[model samples]
Target: MFRKLIYIVISALLLFSCGGNGDGGKTKLVFKVGKVAGQSGYLAQIVEEFENENPGVDVVLEILPSITDQQHQFYITSLEGGSSDFDVFALDVIWVPEFALAGWLESLEGKFTDEQLANFLPGPLKADTYNGELYAVPWYVDGGVLYYREDLLQKYNVKPPDTFAGLKQAARKIMKGEDNSKLAGFIWQGKQYEGLVCSALEFIEGNCAGILDDGGNPVINSERAIEALAFMKQLIDDGIAPEYVTTTDEEATRHSFGNGNVIFMRNWPYAYNIFNTEGSKVKDKVAVKTMPHFEGCESASTLGGWQLGINKFSKHKDWAWKFIEFMSRYETQKKMALNVGLKPSRKDVYSDEDLVKQQPFMAELLNTLLQAVPRPVSPYYPQISLVLQAKFSEVLSGSSSAEQALNEAQTRLTEIINRRK
Candidate 1:
């Protein structure tokens, strides 16, 4: 009788372990979604809404590190091992090509209708597509823009400069008139990291030069490219930008500008919200414009944002796609924009009357978003970016001329591309 009781007890434990959460014996399908850490409260609300709509589906949020490089490494380690731990995950715009090439992301072709796909901005849509297949859906969009002290410009009777020469002239005039030694004429990301690549690309592409041609061949060593890089270096030597920018990243620049010590800043759209927040020194006194271009060239803003993809090894592929679709929906995107200050990937979201009213800056940024350009779209971009960060740092640090840096970058980038062929 003791042996019989032991068997019954073991069976009861198994039954309880297999049972659902008191839902009339119905099992819940749980999906894990991974994203870089930020805006957790609003995201939790979004997950709750998705859960309510789906009933039997539960979403577990897996927050990754805030640093982009760290998040990339984490995905590499997990996806390389074919881990089915995460059902869906966020992809940096630049990572779509790399991840798609590795077969770590499931192809999203035919998942979105033509009308639905067309609603997305072209730059992000292009980034998420590899070869002829779509591998991810754009969650939000970002582009570099010029943030300036609006009150200062108006106080000095200066117009917003559309050309780099005009910007420098305006900045110098403002700095001299303000007579504050602590004030910087301009600021940007100059640290040897992913942000440096984004900042450099804007200058390079603005001068009608690019790191890679449309065919994915290195073209970063051209005369125009050299001139662009040299001009960036000149900004520091001339004292228009601080020498300490060599160690500055996005947040550092944002803080400097927010403290009201900057005349102009080159940063992403996310800074707009922060600059206007309560207690900010520059509150209600800042405005944005497209980055300035050189003569006979057009302005260029680097494409930067995140996308969503299903893990290729996920067990719940269908539910994963549903979550991605829900996240990419107009309502969801609008909530993100309204609550978290993320720019929407959907073109229609930008024109929504409510969004325009609450965030008028979104309307003003439409042209900049429309003209933004992507960095090199090769699957080996991560490798190429590292070479660029090193060489670009050399130029900025006065250790190498622009010509020397670009030539070295060109050689290293070519070798990386050749390996792919």
Candidate 2:
């Protein structure tokens, strides 16, 4: 009995010394990667596939919040605290400059060869670079598009709108003719979040005014920008867009459109696949087009997507890079694009004959993706975006006029940029 007791005690000591069961019989290194919801299954399968070939590595996934703003905050806190909990993470395109500048992400300049870097789409690839250093790999591409009810347009005898003015007229005409109380003429995310910044950028870009000048100075108070914000406010005030939109996020917009409550919606490409899925009420009645523009300007979409990055504090950066490289390959990209409707980062993936056949919209999206405009690339991007979101929300809620809100935003952004200097 004494001998058995001694053996048990030794075993317990050994287990405690080695940090519990994880180090007891470990033959593999376990690492974690994180992303937002809805891609858990697909991402897990991809990691499992990588594990099969690696044999001595385990890739675990950490699911993040669906709200982009919350997700951004989560990353900021995690990475800034030097937490090694997430060795790899998916980053929104606009976060590249901020995270890289803060030294939270690993510089990937020599990790990928010139030929490999050439495979990604130019806009997304450019977004991964900060001060000439590559810090992330483009995982996918996203840009806003307008989704309208084809049946309703035909029923109302109105053509697809080519300009914002035309879109408003069409929406008003359709809503008045239908006389349905539950149906809203148009819908979009108006919440004070990252999505609101993206939506606001689209409006500003479409109006031929952007958030920054060519030299990266704040231009949020331009005449065209105020006009764009006014248009957004007018839409809500005129009853063409619902008042509850001020509380809406991406999922809310999707749910509203999927339930056939919205006549038109402006959202990312992912919404296209969702709305046409089997259970959607708007299936077969939805058609997508690029966002409408003002009279002189061409249509514009705020470039969006996610990137794969290695944490600067991670011990398993080599393995993390291996996982990133694996997912960035043409075959894996094609699989994800075809299976889950994720837009591929690789330029050639969109031109794949098989993919285009399965998703006819790819052919149309190529031009849109090519011309997509990136948001202001700055180390102070987070602050700048917050100012824009707050000011835009003020305009939408009628708490401030477009000119006043934009002027406030401009003042805040200038202070932020100058402080960084």
Give the top-scoring candidate (TM-score): 1
- The lDDT of each candidate is 0.89, 0.86
Q: For model 2, what is the C-alpha lDDT against the true structure?
A: 0.86
Give the root-mean-square deviation of each candidate in angstroms: 4.1, 3.5
Tens-digit lDDT track of model 1 for 193-300: 989999999999989999998788999999999999999999999999999889999999999999998999999998898888899998899999999999999999
What TM-score, computed on C-alpha atoms, does each candidate reach?
0.93, 0.90
Pairs that clash in candidate 1: none
